[model samples]
Target chain A: MGETIDLKLHVWRQSGPNAPGRFEDYTHYAKAIPTHASFLEFLDIVNERLILAGIEPIAFDHDCREGICGMCGVVINGRPHGPRKATTTCQLHMRHFRNGEEIWVEPWRAKAFPIVKDLIVDRSAFDRIIQAGGYITARVGSAPDANAILIPKQVAEEAMDAAACIGCGACVAACPNGSASLFVAAKLGHFNSLPQGKPELDRRVLGMVTQHEKEGFGGCSNHYLCEAACPKEISVKWIAKMNRDFIRASLRYAPPVERKEGYG
Target chain B: MASSQVLSFTRTAIGQKALVAVTGIILYGFAFFHALGNLQVFLGREAFNQYAEMLQSMPKLVWATRLVLLVALITHVVLVVRLARRAREAKPAHYRFEERMDPSEGILRRYARQTMLLSGLIILAYIVFHLMHLTVGAVPGLFFVRGMAYENLIYGMRTPWVAGFYLFANLLLGLHLYHGCRALFQTLGLRHPQWDRRSFAMALSITAVIVGTNVIIPIAGLTRLVGGELPEDPQEVLRTGEEKHTVSE
Candidate 1:
């Protein structure tokens, strides 16, 4: 154990997304805190203190503890996933903070993401958007050889860039407009840019964008904040690509004409 | 799913944005030509009147353009209003003080983002006032003779308040067009990573040309830079009459 750091925290408390929420303050004298302890680890220490004091422990959501799961996200002092760029809340180390520092913590603030509890928001809206058209239609069969597809290096890299989106709701939380354009764009770009996904490109874009709007999320106005807040540092260009595909899909495709009985 | 539902576009945010983008392009074209046409004021009353008369002569063309523009204006206004409302609703809670995470964003970009809706509404009001004063001659004493476009324009702008309003409105238009042009390209799918800066540059340039020329006329009128008094040459007046006759014939 390294030298311990004492700190103060102002955490938001809400029973649900639509429920009334308020900030509650707590003080922790971290007697055995490690300098390299992750932020979540620090929180764990606080939760233990509350449990010993016969107080209800703060509720939050976390999975792998590593940055990959995208399960943990919180607004630390008004920024999504804390002050670090391209870093998740779970990965943020306590060394970034100083002893006796006061931090304001809250869950993601957007109509699309309802708060489930203290510092935990329901991000299931992302799942609905993906369900609309995030996947390419492929027949289940034996895996094909990697060399058979032969994708260009540049194209493969671009696809991978979009595929890096961890489906975190940080983009929505960070956007001034509460828009999910970046997330939606990432999914669209990931599939639409790949050769294997080309056949269903138009349908995917149309379905997803439509579902995005139906989800009651805000529209993007090119603020570029989503790119800045994105843990993966996804490019904002994906948004423009999505917008283009949407317009083209809108005009180029129509349902097949129905035939009258015996008319053909 | 119903085929109609599959083909639907405006039901989505992206679809509404594409609609705004296309209509914006149409309006941009009209604005560019309108500013150019008004630039004829510096060429003297004879030339300016001749230009105005030529436009008025083709009633079919004039009416067609007006009809298209009217439809575009209506569609743009309605869709933008709906989208703005939805965006406002999307954020049920707001920060006590909002700050961008990116330090690189400039003040101008922030201004452009925040004032888009305000500038657009101002432009809409300006358009109505403009039509009343210039097009319909409904502004009693503000606008005089209908056939004398050169005098009407100059004399109408002689009022400092009207001239000031024009200058203010033109400034807002410049801001609106600056953002609109770049977003329009993106909405239309013309964006490429290699050409990212080009969109901003192109948008700024186009805004400069349209807004620069448009403002010059009002400033020229207010400051008496073009000419203090309307052209009074008898021969020039006779040429205008002949030009009008030719246009009508």
Candidate 2:
């Protein structure tokens, strides 16, 4: 339903963390281009075109090429998914872009986020923080059936939703303060919102938030930007939950006696 | 990273919000009191100027105030930066640019993170420029001259930039107070069933006083790009009705 178009892309290219970075430009010329071509497919065609031209392919990170993976993320001109809600890069189609548009695509910018080549960032920090107690230690013995424990459906649904976080760091990358309260809260909320998670919820939130602070991330100012950018549509309301949990834990929960400060 | 030092920001979404709120309250409290105290300068150039003179005159008090404020300011800033860093570190992928009516929107809306950034920068810039304009103009320690005394504040504020920044400072302070006051109460759980209105009212009043006083002084003193004085004590703000009528009559 639309005419074919050509566009220029300015992408961030870096060899590694300690390496200097520069913007590399590529032009895509295409015909019979379906307006509905997914963003990744558009990139696929561009890469194919480059291959034919004997030019080095533009390097970008993507997996699943589907919205679920959260691997194929780019700001796309100036939006997380080219200005859509609950959509990831793979779901983003090229119909959003017009002909001859100059797109600036860059990786997440933050001191903690060391870039690994093109748009890929070293996001192991997420893993480390997650490992710091984003889960529950309340073991459900096999003797108990799933029905043995009663959980309110609303609470269960909320917990499942919080648990839905795919560990995508889009929240952090989207923040002006580079705050990770949303991700941390989602993880904290995942377990805390459930009955099985009730026992260690305190310890989990305390440990995670503490680890988060020590990692040099800025604190949330409660702007709720993370929710908007999150492909999972994780509500930043979990941040409110996390804040309440941390405060409660500090006052009541936490280890019976404090260990040496920062030991864990 | 001690339990005392760390204080946990990523615990829960609500918990993070609480931290934002609690710290915000602390910061706002300090600013409100500081601004309210600064308004004493308008009570008469001599009394106001003398206040500065007295402050510089006492080493122990000055040092104590500086030490205390430095600790407070540092702690506040560190917590904010640390919280922001943790949030960033926890996310695997970050967003690209998103549209905003203002930079302070979005996550910045949490509790004036953007305003904090802005006020922090503006305050930093103001401090340097202000010190250069005031203290550097003097022999550093002197900070005062018989001619260029605290009385010149109005004249000083007469400049658009100075007045504008002061107004900006007041607005920023208001933003800081708006969320922070409620947060402090929420953090301490001081909201009893009976005093909810009173508590919020107190917080709102304090903010209004600080913002209003700061605003009125600049506008009143520099209304004609010149200096004016208020009689000593807090009740003399109405004496300028002569000039008010001078404009009308």
Candidate 3:
């Protein structure tokens, strides 16, 4: 058995969307957590103790507990997903924390992401931005052979790197201005790099950027805090690319003119 | 259709950023040329006065350039103000126990990036004071005369308070220029990974040159290193229109 370590957790607790939140001390319940356990498991142990004491368990979101779902996240000591760089909250192990350490956990903070309860926030703002133009209209009926469309190796690698963004909203949470530029840029770059996504590049960038502004996200000031906080390690170069594409599209790409079918 | 498209474009965040970048380029260009022009003060009295005379010689061209610069400054300020406001509104609630991650860009770069608006506004105020003191000659307690650019500059900077203000404002301008130069390229989508480091170095060098020359001019004036001796009787000198002594080469 791994050595157990004591910890003090100050987890954010909010009753509802309109409710004011505060950090609730779980020091007593969080004692003797196993070092081998994940951060989520430590939370589970604390919740179990809370339930036995006839108290409401901390309401937090988690699924798969494997980090790929991008569901589990909390601002542990002011970082989006604890201190481990590029690792999600679920993947953060308790061993990273020292004995008698104090942990402060809070939900993602952004106007677009309202706190639902405790550490869970409504990240639907990201979805709406995605829905604006994050996809291509190209109809690929089935999974075609990879060699059929010969994407250059470098382009494929870059696209894959950009595609690694899991839509976790960490970029927004970590951004000083609460800008979603990195996230939007990642989505645009992922599609724009590939030939299949080239046909609608202008539409995708314009529509998504327009929606991003409408959602009340701040503009990118190139502080690159989002790049630092991103779990996937997406680069800010994509933002530069997005800016380029947006300008090119705005200047030259005109929308199709509407035609009257019967009149005139 | 084109007009509506232009209007709608300006309404978007990227469009606003593009406007800021374009204006920033104009203002930066003006600053660079302005700094080089002001360095003529070190060339002694006659040379500096002749430089000023040449500038006034082309009144129409000078006024047109001024008009363009004024419009660019206004556009830059307004768009950035809107951007900053939206940024504040986007993150309405503050984190009770927030800790910013260490940026990959060094601390100085981070400080410069965060204080762009603050430095920019201060620089704007400095510009007005600068014009009033040196150009319009409306500043109180300064010996003023029409067509006396060289005399006006020396008189203005000889005052300790006025020279201090110029130094402070020029330092902030340096901070503003450092971030503005780097960010403008990024905003305009002109940055490339291959030469990103070179670009940052270029920005620093440009900022240093402008700030160094600007700061030097005032310090030179304060120490009497530049400019001819001030005549004891300003009224007599104004009436006679004669130099008290030739500036040492």
lDDT against the true structure, per candidate, is 0.83, 0.66, 0.87
Clashing pairs in 3: none
The superposed Cα distance between candidate 1 and the true structure at residue B104, in angstroms, equals 1.0
lDDT for each residue of candidate 1 in B192-230, tens digit (9 for 90 to 100): 878868877977887888899878888898787775755
lDDT of 1 by residue, A1-264 (tens): 666677777777787656888888776534456668888887888789889988788888789889988888888888888888899999999888887777788888888887777778778889988888899778879998999998999999999999999887889988877899999999999999999988888878888887787778988877788898898999988998998888887788765577899987
lDDT of 2 by residue, B21-124 (tens): 65555556666776776777656666766777776789898788667666666656665665555555544443334443124344533546445566665665
List, residue by residue over B1-34, the lDDT tens digit for candidate 3. 1212232578887889999999998988889889
Q: lDDT tens digits, residues A155-259, model 3?
A: 999999999998888889888788999999999999999999998888788888888888889999888888888889999999999999999988887776778
Question: Which consecutive 10 residues in model 3 chain B have the weakest lDDT in total?
Answer: B1-10
User: Candidate 3 - CAPRI tier?
Assistant: acceptable
Worst 10 residues of 1 chain B by lDDT: B229-238
Error of 1 at A259 (Å): 15
TM-score of each: 0.88, 0.68, 0.93
Better DockQ candidate (2, 3): 3
Candidate number with greatest DockQ: 3
Interface RMSD of 2: 6.6
Scored on chain A only, each candidate's TM-score is 0.93, 0.87, 0.96
> Total clashes, candidate 2?
51
